[model samples]
Structures are given as structure tokens and as C-alpha cells.
Target: MAIVVNLDVMMAKRKMSLNELSEKVDITLANLSILKTGKARAVRFSTLEAICKVLECQPGDILEYVAD
Candidate 1:
């Protein structure tokens, strides 16, 4: 199983850039990049909320569960 990150797709749909998201979410670019690229091990709710709020999306928009 895997938790697929749909960050790239969401970002594209939102017409937002990584740097812009990082700044808007008040998160570090490097860390946000890690999450964006699906390299992050976990994500905090607050951070997720911030992302959602800024992107006008829910966690589901960024996360997808894949069966093994």
C-alpha cells in the first residue's frame, strides 16, 4: 500500500508555484518540496490545514491511499 501525494497535480490546478505555496503556508521551501515530491514521512494537521486553507482544498486533494 502507499499514500500517494497528489501535490503536483493540485498545485497545477491551483495555478500556484512551490515557492509561492511555501511562502503562503509559512513553511520552509525545502520541507514543502519534500512533501510535494512525496518524500515526506508524515505531515502535521496544522501544516496540512495551512496548506488546505491556502490552496482551497482538503487533505483528500493531496493524499490518496493505494492498496498494495
Candidate 2:
């Protein structure tokens, strides 16, 4: 995938657990897990906002675009 999710990096930096982030972001653990593992095909802006808000990070911190 050209779009890479850097969720794990951010999580480690924040020292937050997936379950804790899910609760704080008001998202499901299963869905957040998919994002953490870089398995998500797409992420809604609203959800992204929630994640950024909870993680105190920018979207760029979690997502990256790499040319194929």
C-alpha cells in the first residue's frame, strides 16, 4: 500500500495501549486494531479527527504516502 499507517509508532511514543486509545477515541478496539496494524483500506475524516484528538498528534504523524 502506498499509504502507510504509522499508528504503532505514535502509540509507542505516547505510551498508550490500543484498548486505552480506543476508549479515549470512542472507537472500537477491533477497528482501531486494524488501523494499528495498517490493514485499514480507508479512514473517515471524523475518525481521524478523533484519533488525532485523543493521541495529541497530527494526521501526518499517523499517515504517510510513499510512491510505488
Task: Quickly count the clashes in candidate 2.
Answer: 0
TM-score, cand. 2: 0.95
Candidate 2: clashing pairs of residues: none
lDDT of 1 by residue, 1-68 (tens): 29999999999999999999999999999999999889999999999999999999999999999988
TM-score of 1: 0.96
The weakest ten consecutive residues by lDDT in model 2 span 33-42
Global CA lDDT computed for model 2: 0.93
Model 2: CA > 4 A from native: none
Q: Which candidate leads the pack in lDDT?
A: 1
Candidate lDDT (C-alpha), each: 0.94, 0.93
For model 2, residues 1-68, the per-residue Cα lDDT tens digits are 89999998999999999989999999999999999888998899999999999889999999999999
